[model samples]
Target chain A: MIVWLILGAAVMGFLRRVDLYDAFSEGAKEGLKSAVRIIPGLAAILTALRILQASGLMEALQRLLVPLAEALGLPGGAAPLLLIRPLSGSASLAVLEDILKRFGPDSVTGLAASAMMGSGETVLYTCAVYLSAAGIRRTRYVIPVSLAGWLAGCAVVGLFFR
Target chain B: MSAALFLMIVCGVIYAACTGRIAAVEQAVLEAGQEAARTAWRLAGGFAFFGGVIGILEKAGAVRGLVRMIRRPLRALFGRDTGQEALEAISLNLSANMLGLGNAATPMGMRAARLLSAEGGGQPSAALCLLLVINATSVQLMPTGVIALRSAAGSAMPAAILWPSLIASAASTGVGVLLCKLLERGGR
Candidate 1:
């Protein structure tokens, strides 16, 4: 499947006279430039995450969210996944994996997985990618609205899968 | 939430103040910065490559051709000019996202945004809102990220989530687009 997509893209490029080598090299250079622009924001975000982890904020967050999570029909521990989802997909996936392993895949844990599967990692990554490319400094509604969607996804999963 | 915010602020201040002495706070900040840089580099590289590819594809007419192919169905659902180049870019973004190629999707999304901006006469128009809505409620095909997680977790059926994932994404996209349309009309 990946091959087909790549081939299709290549064929399209060829037909359009887009010199593949030039495009790829130029793209790679642009990628480096984007990486530079996002470094500061990324540093701030990750630094905050580290502090949260070190201070056991995540644990406290999980504890505080247990009741709400349970009310939403999610496993009590899944609260961490909710918190993690917006910040980092990798971390959220790790938490989700742990939940699935502990509670079994067909359980409510599995249902949360299903919901998350349907969702993306919220606006953090999206904003980082797009904002960096477009050089947009202000991203007011993207984060809040995307968070709403993430919450909605979690709620739908918790409500329906239970 | 306030407490969390306070703790974060305190930590940040402390970390910032500790210039020397090899404090844990300083170390943590450094490590976090390094990690962030690594992630940023990876993501940026991915986006650049993908964005360039999308640009080349556009120059090549692949995007236009694809838009033409999908125009009918997309128009039936979106109730807009699906043949528009911006629409095609949106579709490509969504498609790449479904494949878990987020870096690839970024350029397409930006292209879409530019197209929409052009169509709206340089204003942030309803198309921007619609783009956001579509992005927020994107449909996925492979659920590659989830499959990877499931496999790492030792699931017997890593791919079992596929069907359900698709259904939920489709439902969300449908609802989100419908809401956008409703809101657009209401705002008018």
Candidate 2:
């Protein structure tokens, strides 16, 4: 997929009499800079998340969210996945696997969990990385809006599989 | 974000201290920093490759072609006049996301975010928020990763999730976009 995109862009650049080499190098320079600039923010997010996970705070948070998950029409078992989904993709995947193992894959809880996992992005991580990369400190409703969307997706999973 | 970071660390330390998991938390912090570095390295390659391709497209005037194609819908969605380059970046990112090209998507999306934020005078504009909302809502046409995982786990119907996933993501994206539009107006 990416190979084709590159080929197409190259062909277009050639046809348009553009300096592909220079353009690519110039753009890549900026891209690298952006990547480097976000390392500090990324470290902070990762450390916070890891600490939360290792300290069992995430588990405690999950326990706290169980009633809310049930209220949202998801299984209480899905609370852990829901709580961790926005913070870490790999952690959420681990939770999904646990769900599939504990509840058979075809069961309501497993199916609902899988459906939710399959549908959403890591909201908090994405927002943090993007905003930090842009040097924008104040998110200004981005977090609330993105989390709302994530919750909406989770809610739809209950309604869809029900 | 500063507040969030502060709270996360402080809460984590207190929790660890209370639970006698201080050593685990310390290890996690040290490991997390290394993991973050590794992740940044992996992402830098994607950013450079995709950014280079986009740069070539921009130079070739193909970005202009792209902007013209999606201009009307995007204009209505963003409700503002943004530059052609910015629109092109936005479309590229969204397309990459829809295609489930995550490695490609992040770099493009970040580029688009940077451009849109720059246009908004370093604040996240409505367009920027909409971009993020759409991304977070999962607009992928295919959930290949889930299907593969299901198949690996010996599921009878690994692909059964395709439609449900699509529908759920679509519903969320719709709601997200609507809220962004409403909030944009409300903010003004």
Candidate 3:
């Protein structure tokens, strides 16, 4: 995939008479800089997520949300992922890893978990970072809308997995 | 976000304390940052590689052509246009996301957000909201990472989830787009 993207871009660059090497280096520099800039926020997010998971908060919530999950047609085992997938990418991936570990990846539970991971986003995390980058506050209607979208995706996953 | 973080930490610690699982809390506090650091490095590596490719694409006018190709459908979807730069950024970001290059998509998405924010007079417009919503509910064409995870976990058919993922993601973005458009019209 990476090879195809580069080759395609390089061919396009050649056709357009652009200096591909120079452009590539420039972008790489910016990428490194962005990486540096995002570290703190990412750390905070990850740390908080780990705490949430470790504290049994997620476990408790899972129990609480199981009925809701079933009502929405999701497997009870999928409760944790369905909740977290939209909150943090890495966190949910960790949850997915755990699910795959416990349930066997080919199990119905695992497929449902994978589908949830595949479909959703790190909604709150993405908005916080992007809005912070733009120095904008008062995130109006974004969280609700995205979460609604996430629920829609979850429902679809439930339909198939069940 | 800070408040949410603070609450999670405090509540988590208290919960752990109450449940005699304080050790887990300590471990989480000590280790999560390292995990984040490692992930940041991975993301940076990807960004560096894809950024170079995207840089080449941008300078090549390829991004422009790509934007022109999608502007009609996008504008029809969002009901507005910001400008060429913003459009290019969004197109590149969306394309990268669709191609499952999330690391590449972030920088491009941020570029689009920066542009849209600048133009929105401090209050993010409906278009900007739609952008964020669409991004959050990204429609995946390929989900390589999940497949890889499934393979690693010994799934006999790792690719079985592919079509399901595509349908779910596509349906998600579709609903998200419609909700944003409705809200946008209502806001106006």
Which candidate gets the maximum DockQ versus the true structure? Answer: 3
What is the C-alpha lDDT profile of model 1 across A36-90, one tens digit per residue?
7667656666677666655555556767877877776766756777677666666
Off by over 4 Å in 1: A15-18, A27-32, A135-137, B1-26, B48-56, B70-85, B113-126, B171-188
Q: Give the whole-model CA lDDT for all candidates, comma-separated.
A: 0.63, 0.81, 0.82
Instruction: Encode model 2's per-residue lDDT on A82-148: one tens digit a residue.
Output: 7788778888888888888888677777778888888888877788777776668777777677778
Model 2 CA deviation exceeding 4 Å by range = A18-20, B119-122
Candidate 2 per-residue C-alpha lDDT over B1-188 given as tens digits, one digit per residue, 9 for 90 to 100:
66777887899889999999999998998999899899889888877877788789888987778778888998888766877767887888888788887766777777788888876665688888888888877889998887777777777887877887788788888888888888888884
Candidate 2: residue A7 lDDT (0-100)? 92
- Tens-place lDDT digits, model 3, residues A18-78: 8878999999987776676666677787787777788888778767888878877888888
Task: Give the per-residue lDDT digits (tens) of candidate 1, residues B1-188.
Answer: 22333566576455444533235455676798789778876777577767666666666777777777877766665456534766787788777877777677666776665565443432234556566656766556777767776767677887776665666566565655666666656653
Extract clashing residue pairs from model 3: none
Query: Model 1 chain A, poorest ten-residue lDDT window?
Result: A132-141
Give the fraction of true interface contacts kept by model 3: 0.72
Candidate 3 chain B, run of 10 with poorest lDDT = B73-82
Q: Give the per-residue Cα lDDT of candidate 1 at B59.
A: 69
